[model samples]
Target chain A: MIKIKLLFAIFALATAFASSAAADMAIIVNPNNAVTKVSSDEVKRLYMGKTKSLDDGTRLIPIDYVDGSAIKQEFYDKVVGKPLDRIKVYWSRLTFSGHGRPPETLSDSARIKAWVAGNSDAIGYIDTTLLDGSVRAVLIVK
Target chain B: MSRWRLPLLLSTALVGGGATAAELKWDGFFTSTYSITNTKSTYRDIVHDDGSFDDSRFGLHVVSDIHPLWRLEAQLFAAGYEDNYATRLDWGFASFHLSERLNLKFGKLKYPNNLVSEYYDVGLAYPWIRPPHEYYSLEEPSASITYESFSGASAIINRRSGDWDLVAQPFFGEVELAESDANISKFIGIKLSASNDLTELQASVAQGRINAEGHELDDQTKRIASLGMHTEWGSLVNYLEYAVTTFSDSEEARTKAGYITLGYHFGHTMPHITYAGFDQESGWGQQSVTVGVKQMLNPSTALKLEMQRITPQLNPEAGAEMASGLFMDVPEKTRVNAFSIAIDVVF
Candidate 1:
């Protein structure tokens, strides 16, 4: 009976660690903005520069985290559904062709959240653990 | 002012004064390649028995957003194509956002002929060190209707339907072909494309009057049509394009070119193969097979190695005069092999 109890405790600990490791990401905008919800496809399109405006005709300024950030990689992998290398190539094509530009990158998630909170037209993604009333979460990326 | 002086001054001024009233962004790309072919004759003026670095090039792109409705963009480029790397203005344009779905651009614009025409010089954007010559070479003897850029205006229209984003571009322009002393006037074209997350389909049609000096192509009406598709299925990627050009009065100049490329990704490395063909109505033709691999060193840099085998088609009964195929100064029918190594980077 003691062996089974110990095994159960170990399994519970592993589950807790896994859940924390796979933390959720939140797509955030200024709390004053009218938008309350956004689809994954819309976020993808906005971040990719395929669309420049929101559904209600508000021009959007998408922001990104700096290169080599672990959260940046996770956001692209989970939300954008494209490998980071492919995204780089796609932006290269657009930038060189004068078609579009990628989002300007900030240093960290705190700055991204702060920027989103300050600008009504800005949108950014951050770890859900960093969420607060300063910004509104439009989409929760799993 | 010299050709290089204006863009340099403009760039300096813009960058220096970028702190106020406008959002300025700067980006650049570079490619350096060494290529050699097993032949005495030069192919594309760069590849021959003696290796050359003439394929290397660099470009700097700048974009200034002055307002919600106005933007300015320019690209300064330098290349080693027999000119000793002279800097020049590749394209400079102003874009006007008229509405949520429409934009107008005026200036020097990249030729909108094929799928890769706009970003062809940026090797990091594609899997090949060089795009297949059979379809991408503008100086190919059989079909030389395309130009690098035109001075004019273009409009972009956008729409969305279900999961696809649709774009339509209509443009009119005039261009001078420096290589052959040709002038294209009254040029008009339209390109339509639909794309989603994993696929894109494109079609375009262009018409122009061509006048080449001291050549048989004088005073000809040229019409070109092309179809292209680029798709990715998980780790598998495919690109296919077919184009045809018809000269109103020169039957022998009617040409068709096509290529299909298949590539599979293995982590950070991809190996690709392509089969390309170019043919004229008078039975002059060439076909090539290219095999290459691209390795991503990082997010913004790539290294590529490629080998190609080109076979020239000669038809004496069809009254074809030259067996040079795409190579220069070849007198007899023969196959040529080429090898190239390149590094591409963007920042």
Candidate 2:
């Protein structure tokens, strides 16, 4: 009985790791754009509104997932150098001061993908599993 | 010959072509501040003499992107000063971007003598209830040492390492004094700033020379130097800055002073304490200490309560005479403790 219980525990742990691996996020852009790879610095500056245009002078429109979403946390942690809580406060100040506006928030990855595919100048990130051929993954945020 | 008219028309035509090709964008900010103070003596108070919102202000910052590499920006600031409305053009300039790391600026700057000087006018950008007067204090009542804040050319360069961010700037300009009789021409100066996230630590140093033309005696030449630092811990932010100023004529007349501020955030409220001091006739010297609490209603608005003690410890004679100098309006051997409450907002 003890041996059987041990095997079951191992199986559960393996499955959990697999689920975590399956949720990796990918940064996506419209397929029509010619640019491919983007440095982590560039991505952070774009999302933070520090840089108004891309390297090619193409106007950039960054989109965000729903607040507190796992993908949102992953992107901010790996790229933006700020946590969700700090970002919310930063956005509040910016919005209230009328200096700038936060990126549009989508309900889920499916909607984010759909919108990015439609807007040529738009950029967003979504789970790799939720991605289809409609939009191209420009760079993986890791 | 219409040679002058031809160039004028050609310039207009070129401008028209560019306007049609690029899109014009607009951006700005609106902000307000209120504060209240308490004093032991009602006769010598310097804070809110009336009630809350004693020093309320509003500003509009406008920017227009003309091209990928050029832009124009301006700011209009207004506040209630001396029981009435006072307004001024705070900042106006045009910038040309040579590259990502290098850019040239020609216009009026807020005398980038300190890191906080640029955004000191934007109250909402900082967590503190109010900007410490120690750093923002003016040498003259009209904010003119020379007719403008600092109108000239400036260059900024930055480089970031793993955990270090470095910024450097050099500028030259002239400031107009209150009388406008003498324009203080600022000599060349270089400022270096560096910060790190591990401690949110920032430090800066500046050195400059100023020359003002006066007919009575020799030109009053002055050398100015300052050092500043800011750091953050969990919910607390601390800042301290010291500046030393001396004149060419008086070797013993140099003055030195500094201020310290400690602020802690409690979700919605932040209580802070500040201490400012300087030596008198050091050409420029004063001492003041303020303690305050700020409650941020939201990201846009806040309320504050502050108390300050103003004393002239260096120049006993000037203190006695109420010399009417910058920050030396009170009599010597006397300290003014004031209490005040204020409300601030940005939109």
Candidate 3:
């Protein structure tokens, strides 16, 4: 009975991990871009308007999802590492101070993917399930 | 051409060229606060026994990249504390993005003396309804020297290393104090800041000459230095700042002030406490403790309630003439309590 119970527990743990992995979001860039991978810190800096270019001097145009979107919430939670309200306050500080501008926001993942595919400088995030050949995933946010 | 004609023509051209002109962005923030103190003496021109809305204010910010390398920005602000809520151009500057790491700005710009000096008027940007009075107030009325805006230029340099981002800003300008008709001339300062996801540190120094008509501080050469740190660990937040001001001619005019704040986030609510104090060479000073709670009504709005206890102190060695501490018509030794409620929103 003990052996059977241990096996069941392991099965449950594996299933949970699988589902969590399936729910992950992907930070995407144009497939033609030279960049292949990105760290969570880099993503946060780009999204927060702290840096305007990549390490290789490539100008980065970060794109964000519209407010109140589930994908946007997940990206901010997992990658940006700040709550929505705090993020708003951060952007307000930068915006009003004329230090930086928030990224232009699109409505949905499909539109973001289209924009990223068309513009080599654009970087955005979408659900991993929405992944396609048009854009390349640089980082997976779990 | 008239001074206004150039901007008029530019606006017309930008409006007519739909696809060529960069998109202009408009943002705004508003804050309303009601506060009252138990004491008979007025505080900061607003807090008294009957309550006042003097903390309320509205501001609109506009930005546009008129050219690939040039940006124009301005803010229109109105505050209840000002006479009749008159709207004023709080900041109007043009920025030249010289390179990826360097930028230059000219015109009227926000004074970058302290941590929150640039966005102090934007209540939604900070947890406090009003910044701690000890280190942020004007020295003539309080114990510190701080200015709102200046007319001149600045150069900002950005550097990134590993996870830390660094910024160095050197500026020069002159400021006119509307409340007291004082002027700060030949002002020059440099601020250095470093930040990561969880922590930020800043240090700055400035030198200027203060000239006030019919005031004791006339033609005084003043120097100021400040240090600040802010950090967040999980749900815990902390802020610490210290500043000192000195005069070249008068040792008795030196002042030191500082404040520390701690807050914890519980879901959408945060409870915070701050202890602040200031000491002047002339014996006038005060210590204050504030307890506050902020409730996030939404992503763009917050409602806050705060209660503060202020205790005035005077040093006999410095002299009896310097008895009042940030208050008018108050007894030498009296503690005052104040309560306030505020709402801040940004869009």
Candidate 4:
């Protein structure tokens, strides 16, 4: 009975660690904004800076994590179907040609939430565990 | 020191309290290439050299969103093709958004054609040290029309449906190039591209009137068409392009060029192979095979090493001169080797 209990304990710990490693990401927008949910394609377009407005003509601002971050890599690899470097290369082609810029980057989740909460047009992402009353969740990436 | 201090103070004051502010974004890129070849003539953007940095170029770009619906952009570009650091305004444009899907731009726009034409100068975006010269070369006896820049008004249409995105642009512009004495008084072209998650397809058609005074035909018009496809699956990338240009004089004088490339990415390294060719009726005919490797230093920097074997295949039966194949001074049916290393960076 003691051995079985220890095995269960180890299994629980491993599950917890796995959950922590693969974080659940949530896309956040300003609470006052009318946007509630966005499809994956809409998110890709916004992040690529293809368009600045939402479906209802509300100007939307997309935020990004700084380079070489774990969550940023996960977001790009999982949601955008591209490596972070490849995405940067795409941006380089546009940015150097004076076409467009990537989204504004923030340092951490706290700062991101603060920025999103203050600006109605802004959007960002954070770990679902960091969810609070300040920003509204728009899309959840499982 | 005073000037720096004043500007710093003003920027701080503007961001701190000012209400009306322009959001400015600045970017820069540089590419330095050194190539060694046995030939004594120029090919594509590079010239005949033992080892020349003449292909090196530096650019600084500034984009300002002065208003939500209006934006201005400019690029200060410096390069030395044959001379020393010559600076020019590469592109400057202002765009006004009519709706979420359409916008109108006015200025000097990058001449758009195939998948890599507009971004051909941006080396870090592609897997090659340089795009295949026989297919993408702007100058000379390679093929037919040259897709460079012009002053124009452009309408850009952007649409997104499901997992695909489409961008179509049509423009009416005036193109003038005095170097080759090929003057284009009026130029009109349209380009349409669709991109899915990992695939992109593009097609373009252009019509132009040559402002010729002593050439083949004065005020004669010609047609150019191009089709391209690019796709990436996992580590493998494929690029294919085919173009044909029809002159006003005769259908036999029409030029054609095409190329295909396959590349595989492994970690920070990507190795690619390409085969391209160009045929012109006036005697110049060339084909090349290029093998290259690109090493990514980081997200914004890369090191590229490439080697190409180019053969100038001129048809003697057509009564063509060796000088028409201007890529090199080598004997006809001989292959010239080009080995190049380039470093590309973005900041």
Predictions' DockQ, in order:
0.81, 0.18, 0.73, 0.67
Candidate No. with top TM-score:
1
DockQ of 1: 0.81
Q: Please give the distance, in angstroms, between residue A119's alpha carbon in candidate 2 and its true position after superposition.
A: 6.8
Error of 3 at B207 (Å): 1.6
Residue B311, model 2: lDDT of: 58
Candidate 3 chain B, run of 10 with poorest lDDT: B1-10
Instruction: Please list the residue runs of candidate 4 whose C-alpha ends up more than 4 Å from where it truly belongs after superposition.
Output: A1-22, A54-58, B1-20, B39-41, B140-144, B178-182, B212-218, B250-252, B315-328, B331-333
Cα-lDDT of candidate 4: 0.77
Model 2 lDDT tens row, B189-223: 56677766424333343333444455422365555
lDDT of 1: 0.84
- The 10-residue segment of model 4 chain B with minimum total lDDT is B1-10
State the lDDT of candidate 3 residue by residue for A1-142, as single tens digits. Answer: 9999999999999999988977798999999998998878778878988878776677779999888888787788888778898898888888888788789999998999999999998999988999999999999888
Per-residue lDDT tens digits of candidate 1, residues A20-135?
75688999999999889888877888999988877767777899987899888888888888778888999999999999999999999989999999999899998888999999
Steric collisions counted per model: 0, 24, 0, 0
Tell me the spans in candidate 2 whose CA falls farther than 4 Å from its real position. A1-26, A32-42, A49-122, A125-130, A138-142, B1-17, B20-31, B34-48, B51-54, B140-148, B177-179, B198-218, B251-253, B281-286, B312-328, B331-333
- Which is the winner by DockQ between candidate 1 and candidate 3? 1
TM-score of 2: 0.72
Of candidates 2 and 1, the better by DockQ: 1
